[model samples]
Structures are given as structure tokens and as C-alpha cells.
Target: MAAPPGCFVGWQPLLLLAVLVVLQGQQLRADFGLPTAVMGGNLVVRDANGINGVLNAMDRAFRRFNPTGQTDRLMQASAVISQIALNVTELGRSVAGSVIKAASDRSTPVDELFAKLQEKYGRMSRYLDSEVQNAIETLNKSIGSAQSLSLKNALNSVAAAVRQITNSTADVGSVIARIHETTSGNTIFKAVDKASIPADLTTSLSRALSNTKDQLTGLSRTIEGMLKNIGTTNAFLARFDQTRQATEKNIVGNQQGVKAFIDGEKDTTVKRYTNTRNAIIADISNAVGKLNVFGTNQTLLALYDKHSEEYTKIYYYLFNRNESDIQNISSAFDAIGHNMEKIVVDSTRSVNSEICYNKYSGQVINTFPGYQNGVVNCMTREKNRLGRITDVMDRMLQLILSTSQDLANNVASCTVWNGFDKSETVYRQAEACLHTNINEMAKFGSIIGRELDLVQTLGDVEVAASRYRLYDCVAARNNEALATIYVLNKDIDGCVSEPGLQRDVLGGGEKGGDEDTEDPYEAGASTTEEPVYDEYLMEVFSNSSSFGDDVDKIM
Candidate 1:
């Protein structure tokens, strides 16, 4: 057969034909050793009979077995094989690029995580508002209750005083005239008539009324002074309001500042961090995108180097090149692959190192909203205490006003030293004077009784203390003198002992052995002992005797 157009013939074609035949069989099992199995699978070797099957089909087309015809047939087979290798290389690049692009995509998870963080921040703001409202409500309730109780107490005190005064004034005439003369007047009103009594008796009665009036005036002045000093409790409330307002402003400002800081952190720091991480992921995706090109170039370089020389000698192989060209091609492909791989590996490391999940672990800043509540609680407690104090001052003012007004009314009606021409009015004034004297004297007697009881208790305490080994002798002597003085002051002539000993001593001392008719004085005195009166004791007795004589003279 004659050589066809644009064809060449030589021993190189024969050897090339034999080499292609051998290579086709091995190419069916060739492993390109790609970095990714996905790209490798797209290569022709993945098929069991990709190269060999095609060659066999081409071989079957050559029925005329002659040298010239065989050379033409071998050349046609190489062209077909080259075309198939190029197509498979393109397919592998496309498939590998798609896989890497899919693997490197991370925008979805990033968006979802950012949205979740934003929701948490929103919930934090809501929680602060709810907490503040609850605290304020509780504070208001506490202050309100305190104010109510204070007002109630003041009103109840005023009501009690008014009721007492009303009962006392119900029957003035009977109240003034009613008197039980069961015992002698011991202190003030010994007799009703000034002519029948000592001058001192009248003087004492006048002094009593003057003193009562003076006490009322003094109390009124004191209340007026307090009312003037405090003026109104509004100042306290104003100051408290100022303090509360300042506290609230500070608390609100702090809460807002903390919230703003968190919001700023999310916007600036957290956003920047997320953006940086996402950028790294994008870079890795770009590197992965380049991996397909590098893989395709490597495959093409190997194929061109292996078959270019043979294709050039056999027939019209347009891609014929030198050994250095093939080596440069391989080197370029290797460099690109190395760089892309490095970018992929390094960018992947960066993505892996990113703190995407739970970025704000324990990052919440405590604004101490409870500190504001504590301030409120303390302020409210102080306000409540101040309110109570104001209530007490108001009650005192009420008492002084009411009592002074009543006294003024009484004094106006019961005028002092009106002429005899006043008739019944003069008599009524005299009666009021006598009644006041009697009331004052009765009060004095009760006071003296209480004083005596107190002294008795003191003496008993001292006497019981004498039983102790450490009791001072001087104190015991003083206590014994006090006891004797108390007995004598009570008009008991004999020394007394403990009540139990008194019962034992007086058991058979009753008249005709009748216990019911026992004398109270003898029963009270456990033993009737004659006291050895010292000088101080005698002086006390003489003063007491003088006191009694003065009382008798006044009567």
C-alpha cells in the first residue's frame, strides 16, 4: 500500500506501533496516583478494558495482513487512542473540580450559627428587662406597706387618747365631788377649806395646778419646736426621691452600657472573627478549585511524554515535542499541584482552628442588676424608718395640741380668785380647785406607795445578797437601815422579816387563837425587835417625824 497524505514511514513507526500495543494493555491497569480517588476514578484506567477494548476493535478493522496496510492500521489506532485519552482527561478534571467545590462550601453552617448567636443576645436583653421590673414591683410593695402601717399606728394612738379624755369628762360634777375618805390624805389635799387647813396646803394646791399648766405649756413648746424644726417630712421624701432617681439612673445606665458593650462585641469582634474564618474557608475552596487543573495537567503531561515521539514518527501527530519540553511540562504540573495542595492543606488547617461552635462560652458579663435592687431595698428601708419617726413626731404633736387645748379650756372655765359676786360660778371654781387638789393628793399617795414597794424590793434584794460570803458589810448595814426606815415610813413600829417567817411567828399570836382576826401589822412582822438606832438612823427618824408633824399641821 502507498503512504497516505501527511503521513511518514520509518523503523521508528514499527517500534512505536509495537510500543503502543504494549502500552495499551498496561494503560488499562494504569494508576495515575492522583491525590484524590474521585479524580482517579474519572481516568480511563478505572474501566476494566478501556484502552485494550478500543485497540481490539481497531485491530479487527484490518483484515488484509500486509506490512504497508499494517503500518496504516497501527497509525489509525494510535490516533483513536490519543483522542480517547484526551476526552477522559477532560472528564476527570471536570469531575474532580466539582467534588472539591462541593466539599469546600461552608456558608450554610456559618449563617445558621451566626443567627443562633443573635437570638441568644436578644434573649439576654429581654431577661434584664423582666428582672428589673420584678425588683421594682417588690420594692414599691414594701414601701407602700410600711407607709400604711405608720399611718394606722398614729391614728390608733390619737383615737385612744381621745377616748380616755371623753370618758374623763362625761360627768365632771360627780367626778369632782366623789371622794373616799377611808384614809388620811398623806401628800397634798389634807382638807377642802383653806380656812380649816394650813396656808401651805392652799399653796401646795395652787402650785400643783401651776405645775400642771407649766408641764402642758412646756410640752406644747417642745412639740412646736419639733414641728418647726422638721417642718414637713417632704424634705426627707425629696432627698429620698433624689437618691432613688440617681440610683435608678446609674443602674439603668450600667445595664444599658453592658448591653451595648455586648452588642458592640457581636458587631465588631465576633463579626470580624466569623468573617475571617469564612474568608479562610473561601481560600481553601479556591485552592481546591485549582486542584482539578493541576490533576488534569499532570495527566496530560504524562500522556504527551509517553506517546508524543512515537505519534510524531508514525503519522501526523501535531503535538510532537522534545524531551526537555516534556520534563518542563511535568515540572510545571508538579509545581502547580504542590502549591495548590499547600494552599488547600494550610487553608484547611486555618478553618479547622476556627472557634465556630460555642464561641461565647461563659462570656456573659454580669451587670449585677441585684446591686440596684440592694440599693433600692436599703433606701426603702431607710425611708420606712424615717416614715415611722415622722409618725411618732406627728403623734407627739397631736398629743401636745390636744392636751394643751383641753387644759386651756379647763383653765378658762376655772378662773382663779373671781369675786364673790360671781355666785354659782365662783362656787363651781372652788369645787374644781378642791377636786384638783384631791386628785393630785390621790396621785401622790399612789406614787408614794409605788416608791415604798420599790424600796422594799431594793431592801429585800440587799438583805438576800447579805447571805453571800462576798457581800460588803457596809452595804448590808445600809440595807438594814433602809429596811427599818421603810417599816417606820409605813407606820409599822417593829422590825419585819420575810413573809414566810412572818406567817410562822404570827401563827399563835392572834386574839383568842382566831387566825381570821390576826392583826396585819403583827402578821407582816416576823419578829417584833427593838431596833438599835444609830445617829444617821435617828436623824432619818427625826426628819420623818418632822415630816409627819408638817403634814398634820397642814391638815
Candidate 2:
């Protein structure tokens, strides 16, 4: 017959065994001439023990039947809890060897069934705990990195590329105008070096192309090195992700196993514990019932049962809080851990604004420790790496600007030469202007070389050197163009000076002598002794737009 669901189907045979044990013990006490009332509790306990011994004998017999060569750990737990209640039920319901006979044809029952459930539980707690510790350590490290990182602020923000480049625009204005005049005046072919200008332009263009090619080669190498570092960072991120995913999978599967183990093991063990408790209650009731028998009254032994064939049987399960509460009582709890990752989120951004360019939510949690340590660790490391790159790149950008400004000053000296008229003596004026421009260009190069040599960020010095070669080639081309003009200007030195040029010198000029020729700040230190902002150095030249600002000690 099919047994009822959600009930112990083997309880029937176990109850019968318990009754037989009680009767046999009663008979033994009668033979010993002991009164039933005086021997009541002791007899029931003795009978229960004897019945448990029989059940252990069952364990030894069934051990050979189950192919698994190990004891059922859950059943073992049940067996230890007032063993009779636990063992009798398992033995009766077991579809293995018949209870009456086991060696008839040496065939066990089920006639056959899955037989791999006999192994006991192992120390899963130890493995899970070790993993948790590692995960937490990683989280702590990540948190620490985030907390300790430094970032830029208004105070620490030195002038970057934008500020540095624009500040020198005034200084180069004249140079830009000169380049325009030289190129445009070449239309007449009337300059002293008119015959040689074409060759000068060709040499300048050729050098520009060659310099560009060299810059491109250096740039390619720099890009390749950066790409390799990026690849390594990506690999590290992938490894971090893989470790997190594997840990999550293991933790999820272990949760399921733990749930199943508790539910299955509890089903049998709780029943055994409950039954033993009920039996003890019933035994006491029966002892009271013995006294009631003399008084001719109803007894509690008739109450602990739901199916008692006594004169009066009131079901305790119906009246007391027993099996009826099964639906209401929680036998299992599903774990739903809440990760409040807000702490990491809130603090990560607050540590340093420059470092917190993006939001980092370290929110992966297989368990509390996994989320707290491992996920936080991984995310923090990834974010911190990005912050570090931004810092390096920002510094690189600043260095590039400083370097570019230096090159611009060198190139601008020739490029921005203008405001001089195209007169017969224009060539002489061109040489004076060229002399001043070239002197400042050489000074810029000297300062730039010193500054660039001090910088070692990501091979920036090498990058700057390559870039300088390209700009220097441009400056060389300009020098050639200016030299052609200088030749023509010098040739006109023998030709009586034009009145138009003479008027420019007398009307739009400062009639200074040796002071104009000497660079007061040739040694590169300011008279005020205040540290010069390297970007601001270009502003101090006599030819610059800000020349009138402070022309005494440093101009």
C-alpha cells in the first residue's frame, strides 16, 4: 500500500516494537515480585534501552546491505537520541533485507535501489572559513588603498597645459607677424638673398619632414609600451573577476547543500527527538494511570495518544501544541544576506576627489565575508589602478605642455618676426630683430634642456628630446629663412638707409644702448629671488608683450 505523505510510515512497526518491549519488561518485573507502581518509570526506561540495543543490531545487519561502506551520519545522530525511537522507524521503513529474515536467498530488499547515501558529513565549515578569511583580507587591502590614495586640489594644481600654453601667446605675437611678412614679401624677389630663398625654403621643408618622421617613430614606441602595460592591467582584472566568479559559484552550491542537509537530517532526527519526548510523557501518564486505576478515574496515559483504545482517550496532539503546529513552526530558514555596500561606496569617493573620477561599488557578495573582503578588494584594486593611470597621465600632460612651451619659444623667435617695413634697409632691421629672436631662442633651449633632463616620468625626457628635435628642425628652417633675409638686410647696409626705415627706428622705439643688448637675467635667477614658474619664464624677454610689466632686474 502507498504510505501517507508528510508522515512517518515506518512508525507503525516501531510502535509495535515499543509495546512489546514494555510488556516483556512488565513480565520480568512480575516474575521478580516487584509491584507495577513501584517499578513503573524504571521498567519503561529499561524496556526502551533494550529496544535500542535491538535497533543497533539492526544497524550492524544493514551496514553490510548498503553498498556504500560508510555509516549514515544523519541516521547515526537520530540513533543516538534515545536510540529506540530513531532506529526502529528507519529499520521498519528500510526497503532492504526483510526484518524477519536476511539470508534466505542472500537477496536484500528494494530488490534494488540507489545505495550511495551512507557516507557521513565532513568538515565543510573549515574550508568555507579559510576562504572567507582570504576574501576579507583582500577587501581590507582594497579599502586601505582607497583610503590612503592622494589626489589633486586647487592648492596643488600647478598650471597645466591649457594655462601654460596660453600665457606665452603675447610673447610669440611679434614672431608670428615676422613669419607672415617674410613669406609674403618673398613675392617680389627683391630681398638681398632673393636668388637663394627658394633653396632655403626647400631645405627647411625637407628638415621639417625628416623631423616629423623621427617624432612619429618615437611616438609609436611610446604607444606600444603603453599598450603592453594596459594589456597587463586587463589580465589582472580578468584574473580578479575569475576568482570572484568561482568563489560565488562555490558559495552558492555550498548554501544549497547546507539547506538540503539540514532539511533532510532534521526530518528524521527531529521526529526521533519528538517521539522520545512523547514516550517519556506517556510513561509518566501511565504511572499516574496506575494510581487512577485504584481510584476508578480517567488517566493521562489515555491522553498522550491520538489512537488509544482505552475507556477515555483525549488526543493531546489536538489539545496541546504538538504536530498540529508543524505548518506554523519554521523548520528551515532561507539565507538572504543583505550587503549594504554603501559604506565602501560612500567612503571610496570621499577619500579623494581626484582619485574618485568614477564611482566604485564593490558589491559582489557570495557570503558576507566574500562581499566584504573579496569583492571590495577586487573593485578597489581596479579603481585604484585607474586613478593611478589618471595621475600619471595628468603629470605627463603637464610635462608635455612645459616642453611644448619651451619649443614654441624657440620656434616663435623666427615665426613671429614682423612690424618692420619692406624698405631698401629692411634687411638691416631684419638682422637686429633676428639677432634678438635667435638669442632668446637659444636661451629657451638651454632652460628647456635643463628642465626636461630633470623629468623622468614614463620616459618623458626621451619624448621631450624627440619632440625638441622636431621643433629644432622647424627652428632651423626658420633660421634659414631669417638668414636669407639677414643676407639681404646686410647687403642693404652698404646701400644708404631708407628714410622709411629710419623713421621706424626713431619714432616707434626705445633708444636704449648696452642695457638693451644685455640679458639681465642671463643666469636664469630672478632679482626678486622668488622661484620662477617655468611656464612664466618666456614672459620676461624684452621682445615679449609683457616686457613693460617688470623690465628691470630680469627682463
Candidate 3:
């Protein structure tokens, strides 16, 4: 095509095509290898085909080959080929602009790949079933016996297209590879980064990569097979792509296993560290808890030892002799209380506890919600009972002292060493005093015995020990009464032997009537079953009296 003289190109939409056409003219002219363009400038209009005239030759060849390859088949193929050519042309224009833009911006140039239904891939891909294939099928159906010549031509066209897919994919791969190299580090970035495709490109990019892989894999599998590679499949695998699918599945499985192993190792390490930390903490806590208990119990053990020692000393004091020292007894009691106060009651002051019980049974009962209070109350009652035992012992001690003073006074008055007359008077008086005091002591002894029983049973140490002293006192008084009765008989018998006294009066009394009334009372006999002197003491008194009488007869 030739441009008009002084042509003014006003079509803005077709400006790129017009420029390409002008370049095509200049190319055609210079291809003669001449030094200059003949009668020309750089400007001229051209057809859609460049100087190679590939579309033009296809037209002319189909027409010339029509005798062998029929005209109708050629015409049908021509339409589909023409559509494919148009799609390629448009895709090329768009890609060229994008590439130029990429060269300027350092961005991805293969913009067409992201498009699902673009001209180059989507429309051109349809040609496998469109004109060239349709023409071959039509001619094949028409054939009665021999293969049609037109079918061969149609097949050649289809073969050419299939070859072009292979050749063109290399060019597309190079462009995509460059884009991949540029975007590898940062998958998602500005305008032409990996985001331009979706899992990170690993989002959009993975899809793009998967699409390329599937296309290449499908192409490789497809070209390796004949018609059998087209459509048949099972649920397990696409029959045409079974080998490639298996390869991809194995690769994916390996990647997942590697990821899972790394993750498992990380989790195991974390769990191990956590368990170690917990175990160490537990050990530390256990050791510290034991140490704390050991430290806290030192005072408790000391108090127990001290209490035991004091308890021993107190028992020794109360029961060791016929008389117990109240000071020693009080001191031991107070010391034990002090130890309890420090060890038991001191800490119990702050401690609160929940105490529960079934309360329906009928009995003497005291209840509180807190166990600390209950412990305090029990300790107090124990102390009170101990105090009550001491009080009982105190009363018994006072009674002993009173009775002991009377016995000592009466024994002092009766001068046993004097000659019988004066001694007899004092002795008789002492005997009457002894009898009265003995009887009085016996009454208190019964009382003390009962009190001692209670003290021994109820009291822990103090009152239980006092039982010995009280019993000793009672025995001592009984012995004193027997001694007094024996001395009185000796005094009265010796006085009868002296010159001043008569024997009859000495044996009984000064008056016979008085002797009948008073002397009827026997020595060492009492109204109650418990005698002031036991049988042995009474026998000692009677025998000594008979000895005095025998001594006077011998004189």
C-alpha cells in the first residue's frame, strides 16, 4: 500500500498501526540493500500484514492448492485462520505497549499472562476445534475410501498451529521468568509485582505459577500423545495428564512433609522447655516448703522438751515427801503454761479454721465455727481443771497443818521423863487430847482420801502427786496417837507405885461411880469402823501397860 501525497494522519486510535505501517514501507525499500529509498520519504501506509506477507501467502497458496485441496475446505479454514490472525495481531499490539511500559518502569512486561481470556492465549486456543479442525473433519466425513487431499492441507494447518503453541510458549516463558526473577524477593509490591497475579502470587503468584505449570505440563503431555490424550479420565486421575499429575502430587507431598517435620520439631522443643521449667519450679517449691517446716518446728520441739522436764520435777515434788512445796508446784505449772502459750496458743490466735459436725445427738455439747477458738477453750478448761486439783490439795494441806499443830501441842505437854505423879496428870490430859485429835484427824483423812482419788484420776501431775503426802500425814497422826496412849498407861501405872496415889484410882479414876461412867470407853476404840489407831497400835499400848504393872509387882 502507498500513502497519499502530504497525508495528514488524524486517526488517534490507529496511530500505532499507522506508524508500524510506515516503518514496514521503509523496511521493504531498504531490504533491496540499496543505499537509499527511491523517490521517497520515511512515510507510507501499509496493509495489516508486514513485508513477510504471511497471511497473503496463505491465501494464495490455498487458492493454488485448491485442485488437490478443494476450495470449500480452504474457504472454511480461511475463516478460522483469519480470526486467529486477528487475535494475534491485537495481542501483539497490547503486549508491545506493555513491554515498553515495563522497560520504562522496571515492572513485569508479561501482563497478558494474568488475563484468563486474553487474545493471544484464549481466542487462539479455540482454533484446535475451530476452522482448521472443522475443515479436516468435514473432508474426512466426505471421503468414501481414500484420504482426502484437502484433509491433508487442513491437518497441516492444525499441525502448524500446534507447533506455534510450542514455539510461542518459549517466548512467554522467558517473559514470565524475567518477571519471576524480578518479583522473587518481594512477592507483593507496587504495580507490576507478584500481587498482580493472587496465596501471596505465593497468593496470586502461586496461581500464576500453577497455571503456567499446568499449561506447560498439559502441553508436554498433550504433544507426547496423539488423539488419545484429549478427554478420557477417572476419579483418580485425568487420563491424559496422569503421569504429570502424579509427579506434582509427589512433589507437593514432599514439601508438606518437610514443613510438618520442621513444625513438629519446633513444637517438641517448646514442650520440652515448658516441662523442664515446670519441674524445676516444683522441685524448688518442694524443697523450700520442707525447709520452712523444719525452721518453724524448732520452737515447738523445744517447748515439748521443756514441758516434759517440768512435768517430771513437778511430780517428784508433789509425791516425793509427806509435804509438797506449793511454790515448786506452782512454778512447774506456770512454766508448762508459758511453753504452751508460746508454742501452741500464740500461733493459734491468728489461725481460723472451719469446724463441722453432726449435732443432732443428745449430749452436752459446745460448738463453734472456728477450730482455733475450740482449741483455746479446751486449753483453758484443762488449766481450770488443773487449778481445781491444786485447790483441793491446798484444802487438804491446811487441814493437815491444823491437826498436826494440835498433836504436837498435846505431845509437848505430856512430860514422859518425869516421875509418875506429875507426868500422870499431864499424860492423862495428853491422852484425852490425843483421842479427840485422832478422831478429828480420822474424819479429815476420809475426806482427803476421796479428794486424793479425784486428784490422782483427774489431775495430770500436781494433784496426782499430792496423794502420797496426804496418806503419809494420815499414817503419821495415827502412829502419834498410839504412842500417846502407851505413855499414858506407863505414867498412871508408875504414879500408883509412888507414895502419893492409890492403885484403884490409878487403874480407873478417883471416884468409883465416875470410873463406871468414864472408864467403860475402851482404849483405841471409836464409834466409827475406822479406828484412830489400828489393831497393831492398840496392842502396843495394852502390852506396855501390862509391862508397867509387872515392873511394880517385881519391885
**RMSD in order of candidates:** 68.9, 59.4, 50.2
Q: Where does model 3 exceed 4 Å of error?
A: 1-327, 339-373, 399-403, 416-555
Say which candidate scores most in lDDT. Answer: 3
For 49-90, candidate 1 gives per-residue lDDT tens digits of 232333233233222222232223223322332332233233
> Could you tell me the TM-score of candidate 2?
0.22
Clash count, predicted structure 1: 0
Model 2, which residues run further than 4 Å from truth? 1-188, 191-219, 232-255, 284-320, 323-555
RMSD of 2: 59.4
Q: List candidate 1 segments past 4 Å from native.
A: 1-194, 236-262, 294-555
Location of the lowest summed lDDT over 10 successive residues in candidate 2 = 546-555
Query: Per-candidate TM vs. native?
Result: 0.20, 0.22, 0.21
- Local accuracy of candidate 2 as per-residue lDDT tens digits, 1-555: 888875557688789878886665443322211112221323322333333344344445333222121113212211222132233224322312221121121222211211111110011112222322443233223222111111111101111211221222212223323333554423331223223223333233233323322332332232232223223323333443454455445444443444454344334433543443344335333432332221221222122121122212222422243452322211211111001122122212111111100011121111224232432343333323332322443354355345444433432333232322344244344345445433443354354334323322333333233223322332233233223323432332211122222111111122223221222223345422211111111111111110111000110
Model 1 worst lDDT run, 10 consecutive residues:
546-555
Candidate 3, residues 1-555, lDDT tens digits: the string is 556776745684388777876665444322211011211111100111121133333333333322222223223433433443343334333332322232223322344333421344334345444544554454333221012232233334433443443343334334445555564454232333322322121222223323333333333222222111110101111221233334334433433443343334334433432343234234323322322221223432343233334333323332443233323343334333432332232122111111111121011011111222333333344444444544544454444444434433432332232222345554455345434433443343354345434433333354333322322332233233323433443443221222222122111122223221222223326622112211111110011112111111100
Tell me the TM-score of model 3: 0.21
User: Candidate 2's error at 456, in angstroms?
Assistant: 70
